[model samples]
Target: MENKYQFETERLGFRQWKEEDKIPFAKMNANTKVMKYFPNILSREQSDEFDS
Candidate 1:
């Protein structure tokens, strides 16, 4: 039988997190404007550890 569950996107693909996404995720966290509401911008290490 074919799989019953599937996920799709228009411009991007979706999948479980992998080790490769660490850098981009960290960049987002390190961005001051993105984190303006928070007390401070996240460090690379912090961003690496943070979950979506």
Candidate 2:
């Protein structure tokens, strides 16, 4: 597959969301520790809707 990136630094990279990333990103959003700054954990459905 071809690489898709929005931008990159010497040691970091960034990109916009792709269809394949929704599920994994939702999983990350569902992690309480990862969402610690937020008031509550998000359900997978809610997380899935985050970018919608």
Candidate 3:
């Protein structure tokens, strides 16, 4: 994969989103704690749809 920009911190690397990040991104969106400010937790289907 190629990114136009890349940067490294003491313990982390930052880059643009990749296709492989979809699952983890979906999991984050589906997490109840992460969605506490919203109306409700997202279903897997909803998360998948949103990630698209």
Candidate 4:
């Protein structure tokens, strides 16, 4: 398989977001428990626009 990750460790990997990551990222942004400190849960479009 190709190594698409920017870097990896025994237990972790880091890479820029891919097109496939949007759905999961949006779901995470919409999680109340996970976003307790945020002003509000993000919509899918907002999550899609997230930078950094």
lDDT of each: 0.77, 0.84, 0.76, 0.92
**Model 4 — which ten-residue stretch has the worst lDDT?**
43-52
Which stretches of model 2 miss by more than 4 angstroms? 1-3
lDDT of 1 by residue, 1-52 (tens): 9544355668765566778889888887889889889998888888876555
The window of 10 residues in a row where model 2 has the poorest summed lDDT is 43-52
Which candidate number would show the highest TM-score if scored against the true structure? 4
Candidate 1 similarity to native, TM-score: 0.59
Q: Per-prediction TM-score, please?
A: 0.59, 0.65, 0.52, 0.73
Give the CA lDDT, 0 to 100, for residue 10 in model 1.
80
Candidate 4's TM-score reads 0.73
Strongest candidate by lDDT? 4
- Model 1: lowest-lDDT 10 consecutive positions: 2-11
Native-to-model Cα distance after best TM-score fit, residue 22 in candidate 4, in Å: 0.4
Q: How accurate locally is residue 2 in candidate 3, as Cα lDDT from 0 to 100? A: 66
| Predicted candidate 1, C-alpha RMSD | 4.3
Q: After superposition, how far is residue 36 of candidate 2 from its true place, in Å?
A: 2.1
- lDDT for each residue of candidate 2 in 1-52, tens digit (9 for 90 to 100): 8668778899988988788998888888889889999998888788778677
TM-score of 3: 0.52
Runs with alpha carbons beyond 4 Å of true place in candidate 1: 1-14
Model 3: CA > 4 A from native? 1-5, 37-52
